[model samples]
Target: MLARRLLIFSRQFVNFTPVIRRQFADSASQTKTVKFISGNKEFIGKGKVGDTLLDVVVNNDLDLDGFGACEGTLACCTCHVILNEKHFEREDRTNPAGEEELDLLDLAPEVSDRSRLGCQIKIMEDDPEVIEVRVPSVTKDQRSA
Candidate 1:
């Protein structure tokens, strides 16, 4: 009985623990620019430490069509992006393209050495203030029934 009670209590603690929120400076003060290579248009996005690239893009209304079609579910490669070489291999970034992410990259149009799913790229505390994103000029119509 005692062991069962302790296990239940531990599970409760784990389930009830609140998720810690990441904070960032105001968007006005620290506006991060997400540049689009195709249109040469730049949108401002403010990202907290844990914010994904998709989060920043959608939150700022950058007007990139066919983006986040899967809403970061990893079900499709709609948010496929090519990161500049400078940022793609940054040593400080905690997120790396895993095998599954790599496999999905093969489905994205114009896959490149620097291709990465925007949803998988999170803004760590030490990430650069300006992140350049390149949307492939062509996107496949991956709509499903």
Candidate 2:
């Protein structure tokens, strides 16, 4: 009957509403804003938690050029980023840098105590810190050349 069809459709829609809202909420919850400062330009990027810092830059199409030349595999150091001291010192950091990352950081020009491969930093979802990354004006393919 027409009434039966209407009731079924209404129930279906009701069931789907939660699913749709949850999808949106899940995606929103995963995303966090991160800042990339270069020279005089400050770029803000929205990145999902669990994604590497380089992923944030590339995903958001920020003005950072020649970044993440290695696609975050740690095979390259082109994604070098200087993390904010306050953010780096957070106890929530995924972990200490590995030998591979340290070795690559050494190759980066103007290396500093806070220098880290963008691919190494995993933006934690629960952490309340606003991520700050500095992309040096120069890199040693510097440009995947």
Candidate 3:
């Protein structure tokens, strides 16, 4: 009798899991727009709240040269982008750059005060600010080459 009761309870919980997951997914999937400047060209990309900047470039099919060479891994700085200093240093920036990312940036060309690895920066759900990003004209990830 106890085994049968447990099976019924488990079935009910399984059936209810999808509703809970859908709600969370909806919030995380909120779209955010970012402006990317690559040399003389400008592109607008849409990304979800939890997506990394690299994800935005790839998903929106933006023509960023050699971006995300490491496929969002911190191993390379190919996804380097120059963000507005204020936005980069925002207290509420979701998934800000960590030690590893900072170290990798040192090796990238055109390193600037505003430079950050796109893979390390995630869009925040509450941030109403439109991000302006600058893609360096030349990107060389020695590790990959």
Candidate 4:
């Protein structure tokens, strides 16, 4: 009976080993790093998978405008920026621009296909390469204010 019990325990241990190893492997695979470049500036931020672009910018003091106005609420498009082509492709899906954001973007001077509110973009750090985005001038309202 003791031998039978030991046999059952051995089987359970064997079965659990792969599960433990897989969990560790998955966590290792999910680790991510973030890098930002705007014109002459560049920075690398150590981030997990779900960090927002604004989070990195805020933490790094990336000289983005509108950040002081809206406080990252997405209320004002002062943090308007253009995502570089390489960084644009790294985003998982294009987050749909809300009516409020669209209206705010209208207040931005140089709106384009690549225009995005920095506060609205959440970074997906799954890619192997660093992402780059550019901060544009402040919105008309912010500039005048």
What are the Cα lDDT values of the candidates?
0.67, 0.72, 0.74, 0.59
Clashing residue pairs, candidate 4?
none
Query: Where does candidate 1 clash, by residue pair?
Result: none
Q: With candidate 3 superimposed using the best TM-score fit, by how many Å does residue 45's alpha carbon deviate from the native?
A: 1.2
Q: What is the Cα root-mean-square deviation between model 2 and the actual structure? A: 13.8
lDDT of 2 by residue, 1-145 (tens): 5774575456446544654566577766456788888767899988766666888889899877788886766667888878777767762253567676788888988787888888767676554557778877753564676
Please tell me which predicted candidate would have the highest lDDT against the true structure.
3
**Alpha-carbon TM-score of each model against the true structure:** 0.66, 0.69, 0.70, 0.58
- Candidate order by decreasing TM-score: 3, 2, 1, 4
Candidate 4 residue spans exceeding 4 A from truth: 1-25, 28-39, 43-46, 63-68, 86-94, 138-145
lDDT of 1 by residue, 1-145 (tens): 6774575456434423321222323232233555556545555667654556788878877777778897876667988888887678872254467676787888887888888988877665455676667887754477943
Q: Lowest summed-lDDT stretch of 10 residues in model 2?
A: 11-20
RMSD (Cα, Å) for all candidates, in order, is 8.9, 13.8, 10.9, 14.6
Better model by lDDT: candidate 3 vs candidate 4: 3
- Clash-forming residue pairs, model 3: none
TM-score winner, 1 or 3: 3
Question: For candidate 3, lDDT tens digit of each residue in 1-145?
Answer: 6774575446435534654466497754577798889777888899866567899999999878578987865679999988876777772254356576789999988999889988766666555657788988855577886
Candidate number achieving the greatest TM-score relative to the actual structure: 3
What TM-score quantifies how close candidate 4 is to the native fold?
0.58
